[model samples]
Target: MNAYRAKPLRYPWPPVLYAAAMLAAVSLGRLAPISVAQSQGLIPWLAGGALIVVAVSLDIWAMKTLIERQTAVLPHRCSSHLVTCGPFRYTRNPTYLGYTIMMVGFGLIMLNPWFFILASASVALTTAFAIRNEELHLLSRFGFEFERYCRATSRWI
Candidate 1:
């Protein structure tokens, strides 16, 4: 799908959907026991912080590369270049991966098992929608070169 030709909600809805779920969990989820919450302490905070940092950095890195490469970031826009450098070498969809990791990190921070459930839903939505559509678009646009990239990189790490 050429990104410019695609509508907003049709292409990038995961972030909004995840945010809604996160908000719902925060407001409606049963808080874990005080003991449980307390015990899930510094480590979770540290780890979650680390994951968020990584996630944001990966997104920055990938977006920078895409911009430098003169490639379109929008799913329905024309892709002028296929970026294989930086984080793209590792994951086909670093932006999507970043969002997934962010969900996990947010879950860790919240200490609510429901947040983890939200993260799982995030992953499932990401896979079923974002990645699937992007993969098909990339494959159709880039053809064999995209296939080689796919062969070399995992979808997510």
Candidate 2:
């Protein structure tokens, strides 16, 4: 059976789910982190800001591609087309990767080692929660074309 067909919980959406995971990470990180990237420094702020910018840029690019293709962006909906241009050319999931990158920036701003740990967990959860089903749907709808695209592109990078 395909992954999407075998799926159970599909609520909370990927973005919301990701945010909740990040928050959980921050809460745990506040308890006793091994080390902080920066207790007090301008570099931390600048680096966090830079990472956020990078994340936003990738997200925008991916969304633009979706709009151009007239494809549905939401996971629950079927896409009208398999977008292979722009950020999709590099990663099958630029939007999710962008969110993960933003979470990393958040961890940097918080200067918490635990947040990084949580971010890693979040990535795995995201892969299972969102990416797998999304891939399954794409595969079912587009068949071999989507498989070829998957072969050509990274899941995240």
Candidate 3:
């Protein structure tokens, strides 16, 4: 008899992509600064701050849920089971969504157009490298349960 063992992910692409995008945005902004508006006021700061708070809240909720479920939070590690509670009930990729939202909030706060652009790129890269791979692993491991969850929940909100 052959026993099937799930293989772990090769790289933690979500955080890495987000970090790289942020670095690129900062570097590009420093080289040639692009402001959202010439006369930036309190509006941007308020909106950015609100978004940051929401993103942080969502991330914390998701992480807490993962911990409570006793599942692996790291991208490279294999999750023990399908998580469909708390934030997972809404979005399949809450952590990645939170990262994207935080990047957008930072873009607004810094008044840097590059951050916005790089944030989109980060999503694309993360989807291609991280999310897709994670989905495959989950489907292989959890099969029907994962499929049911995917059908019910959106990838990102």
Best by TM-score: 3
Candidate 3 residue-wise lDDT, 1-157, digit = tens: 1122264467776788898899999999999887555545788878888999999999999999999999989888878978999999999989999999999999888888998999998888888877887888888888898899999999987
Count of steric clashes across candidates, in order = 7, 0, 0
Give lDDT per model, in order: 0.75, 0.79, 0.85
Once all C-alphas are superposed, what RMSD does model 1 give against the true structure?
A: 3.2
Error of 3 at 106 (Å): 0.6
- Model 1, span 1-64: residue lDDT tens: 4652233225557667778877766765555432244544589888888999998998899889
- Which segments of model 2 are wrong by more than 4 Å? 1-12, 37-40
**Model 2, residue 60: C-alpha shift (Å):** 1.5
As a whole number from 0 to 100, the lDDT of residue 123 in candidate 1 is 81
Top lDDT hit: 3
List ranges where model 3 is wrong by over 4 Å.
1-5
lDDT at residue 89 of model 3 (Cα atoms): 90
TM-score of each: 0.83, 0.87, 0.92
lDDT of 3 at 42: 83
Score residue 148 of candidate 2 by CA lDDT: 95
